[model samples]
Target: METRSLRDDEVMKRKLLIIGWDGASFIALDGLIERGCLPTLARLRANGFSAPLNSTLPPVSAPAWTSFITGKNPGKHGIFQFYEVNPWSPKALGRGQRTHMAVPGVVVNSRSIGEAKFWELMSAAGLRLALINLPMTYPPAPINGLMITGMLTPPGARQFTYPPELAEALPPYEIDLNPREKDFSSPDAQFLRRIRDVLAKRTRVALELFRRERWDCFVVIFTETDRLQHRYWHIVDPRCDASEWAHIEADVVDVYRQLDRALAELVRLAGDEYDVLVLSDHGFGPAAIKRLNFSALAERLQLFVSTGGWERNVRRAFNRISSSKRRIYKYLTPLVPERFLHRAEAGLKTLARRGVKAKLIKLHDYIGGVWINTTEHPGGVIEPGPPYEALRTQLMNRLAAVRDPATGKPIIIDVRRREDVYHGPYTTAAPDIIFILDDEYGIETGGRSSELILRIPQKNQGTHRREGILIMSGRAVRPNVQMARANPTAPGIEDVTATMLYLADVPLPEDLDGRVIEEALDEDFLRRRPIRRCSSSRRPSPDVASEVWESAEEEAEIRERLRELGYLE
Candidate 1:
C-alpha cells in the first residue's frame, strides 16, 4: 500500500487480464472461430488487433512463455531449454560450481524461481496479481496476491500455492499430465474423462480464486490444449483424420467448445471493466519430430565420439520402451554427467581429435536437434579458434543437406549457429547447430535407430511452428483489426511483458529484447499515454540462474509427466 502512487480512479481502472493457451496457434484458432466453436475468443479478437506472434528460436513453452513474461531472449533469461545444464553437486565438476542445461525441461524446480518474473515486479510495485497455472512457474512464489504454478509443478505437493494451504480447499488439483490422455491412437473413455475432469478442476480452482481474492493483474494459462495437440494431433488437425475413430471428430470440437465456454465464464466474471489479452507460447502443427542422430552422422564423417555406442543405445532403447519419455530420460541422465558430456569422438581423437567430433548431449527440447559437445565445455575438444569455426561450417552443411530417403526433399530447411540467435553470458550453452525441419513436407526429427529415421510418416501429426496466437482486446484497444504483414513487422512473444507493463502505465526496462507492439493498441490510447522506457540497470529473479530446485526424485517424476505429455525425449 505504501508504494501506491495512483489515484483511486486510476487504481480501479487499471485492471489487466492475461490468459495463456499453451500451443495455441492462430492457424488452429481461426478454423475453430470460423466454425463457430470458439465464439468467446472470436469476439475478443474482434474487439482488439491480433496476429500470429513469432515464437522464440526453439518455440518451446518454457522459453516462449518466459520470453513473454520477462521481455528477454533465452540468452538473457537463461531458460533456453527445460532441463538446463546441472553440472553442480561439488563432485559434478570437482568444484563448487553448479548448473543446469539451458537446452530444455524449462528448469524443473519444486521451489519458486530465483529470477524476478514480471509478477514479482508488480508485487514490488504494490499491485495485486493472481497467476494461475502458468507453465515454467512452479512452486508459486509469494506475490501480493494469489499465485498458482502450472504443468511444471509436481503433483501431490501441498505447497504449490502462494498461501501454501490453498490446495486443501479444492477438490485436489491436477498439476501434471501424461501423453496417452491426448493420444487418440489408443483413445480410451477413462483417459478422455480424466482429461476433461482435470481441466474442469483447474478452471474451478481459478474461478474460486478470482472470486475469493481481489486482484489487479490476473493471468490464467490452460496447458491441456498443448498436451492434446501434441498427443491427439491426428484427430483435431484438419490436415489428417482417422476414418476409424471418425466418430470422435466432434469430440475434438467439443474440447474447443469447452474452452470457449470457460472463456465466456471468465470474461463474464470480469465484466466490461477488464482488458483481456489472450496468447499462446507457440503454434502447433502436425508432429514432424525427427530425432536427428548427429552422433551417427558425425561418426560416419570420421568425427564420432568414443562413447557413441553407449549414447546411441540409450536413444534407441528410449524409442523402444513403451513407457513415457520421463522414466527413460531419467534412466539416461545418470549414465553421463554434464562435465564429461562434452566428449570427443574416440579412435580418431583419443586424447586429441581432428576437427570437432560432435556428440549430442541430450534432446531436451525434443524437436530441437542435436546439441554438439564442442570447446564450449571444460572438456570440449573443438577449440574456439579456426578448428571450431571449420567444424561448425562442415556440420551445418552436412545436416542441412540431409534428405528424406522416401521423398528426396531436404530434411532440414534451415541451419543456425548459437551465436546467430542467442547472446549473453550463457551464450556458449546453446547447441552448436540448430537445424530446422521442413514440417510442411512431413520431415520429422527422426532418430538414427528409429523406424522413421530419414523417412516421412504416413500422416504429418504435430510440431512447434514459429507463429502462435496473440489477441489484444480491452478498453484501450481498436476493434476488428487483423494484423497485416505489410512490412517485415510482426510481434514476438518477447513483446508481451513490455506491452503489459505499458497497459498498467508502468515504465519498462530498455534491455528487453522485444519492443512494445504498438500496432495492437488504439491510436487514441497511445496518444494519451506514451510508452516510457527505463534501463536494465534497475531491473534485476525474473535474475535467477544456476540453480536446480528439483531433487532426483522430483525431476524423475516431472520428466515422466512431461514424457507422458510428449513434451520431452
Candidate 2:
C-alpha cells in the first residue's frame, strides 16, 4: 500500500480553535453591534463572515450541546433531555438536578449517556485536544489530551482529566467567584466584580493552556451568555420596566463585551498559530410562558381525585394531624428542588404508605406530570400512555382553552406530540407530552399549597427564545456566509466536528449525522475536499457515554468536587 502526502501548499493548515457561546441571539447581536457595544465582534464580522447559527428543535441545552460536540441528533446521541433516562429500567433522574435519592454508587452506576462525543473522534486522529467547561461533560475520562468537564460535573471530585504531567502544569482549580451564589444573584456591584475576576482568570488560564502545549486544535465553550440570559432576559425586553431591569441589562451587555474582548485577545495570541472558529450551541429568548406547573395543571384537570370534595380542605386536615403525629418523618421527607415550597412530603414510598393508613391525598407538585403506578385510581386519569391519541386530543383541547385572564387571548402556542417535537427511535422516553406556551404567556407556581387554575398574572419575565449566532473566519472559510432568513441556519451542534476536521485535514466518521458545512469552507486552501459520510442513514443504535472510572475512590473524588462547585450535589 502506498500513502501519498500533500505538498506544503496543498495541505491545509492543521490548527483550529473554536469558541462557543451558548444562547447568543442574532437579534441581540445586531442591536449591540449597532450600539458599538461589541466592537471586536463587529470588527470580526466586517473582515470575516458571521450569521445566525440555527440550533436543533426544542433548543434546550443538554441535547443541543451534545449535538454540537457529536454532530448527531438526540436520536443518534440518545441524550433527549436534561436527564439521561435509563431505558432499560425506565427510570429518569430529575432534570438539570444531578442527584437521585438513591445511594451514590447506585446513581453513578445507573445513570448513563447515549453516545461517543467529539473528543473521542479527535482522539482517534491522535491530535492534542483540550475541552473546557462544556455542559454535561463531567465524569471526565481519559482522552488523547486534557479534559475539564463542565455541567453536571460532581462536586469535590477532580472534574478535569489530563496527562499526569499536564495536570500538574495547569493552574489549580479554585471556584472563580468567592461566593459562587453571587454568580446567580442580581447583576450588582458584587456580581460585576465577580464577572471581571472570572474573565481575567479565564484569560490567564486560556493563555497558559495555549502556551504550555503545542495543541493541534483547541476548543473552548463559554456558558456565560446562557447564564446571563437566564438571570436577565426580562431586563433586556423593551416591554418590561427599564427601572427594574436596568442594571441587569447593562450587566448582560458587559458580559458579552468582556467575552468579545477576550476573543480578540485569543485571536491576537493564536494569530499565526491556529485557525479560529467561533460558534454557539443555541440562542436564548424569553420563554413563551412565565411558568406552568404541569403537576398543578394535571391536578386542576381532576387527574388526581380526593374522596373528599376539596383537595385543599382534605390536605389541610391531613397535614394538621400528620404534622402533629409524624413531625420527624415530615422534616426528614425530601422536598422538591424548587426554592420555596408549600409542603414537604415523604418520598414515593412514604406517600404510598400514607395513602393506605391516613387519607388518600391526590396531588403532584412537580413538572412533566407524576408517574402513576396503577390504572385503578383517579390518579391514573392523567397517565400519558396506552390511548396516546385520546390523551393527545384532550391535551390539545386543554392547551387551546388556556387564555390570559386579563386579555382572554389564547396563551398556548402549540401542543406537539412527543414524536413530532422529538426526533428519535426512543420516543417513549422523549417528553411523554410537550406544551408550547404562547409568545408571552408566562406561568408561575411557587410556595403555594392550593392548586388553582393556570393563568398569567403578575409579570414574571424571562424566556429561552429560538435563535442563536454563528461566525466562521479562517484562510479556508468563505466570507459572507448567508444564514437562513426565516430561522437561524440549521447547523446541527454535531456538524461543527466535521467542519473543524475538514479545515484540519482530518477524516470524519461515516456514522456522524452532520456534514462539514461546506458553505462556510475557505475555498482557496484545500488539497482535497473531505469525503463526507453519515454515521448512519437510519438512526444508529444508541451508544451511551462510557462508565470508565478507575476506582470507587476516584469517582468519589470527582463527585465531591462537582457538589462543591454546585455543578452537582
The number of the candidate with the highest lDDT is: 1
Off by over 4 Å in 1: 1-13, 85-107, 110-115, 178-186, 289-295, 305-356, 361-379, 440-460, 484-488, 537-547
- Per-residue accuracy of model 1 over 8-72 as CA lDDT, tens digit each: 33643457888888888776777778989999999988877888788887787877887877777
TM-score of each: 0.80, 0.73
Alpha-carbon local distance difference test for all models: 0.65, 0.55
Reference-based TM-score, model 2? 0.73
lDDT of 2 by residue, 329-446 (tens): 4564465343223344422212322121001111111112112222333223334356545655665576567665566776666655656655555455444455555555443433
**Candidate 1 positional error at 227, Å:** 1.6
Native-referenced Cα lDDT, model 2: 0.55
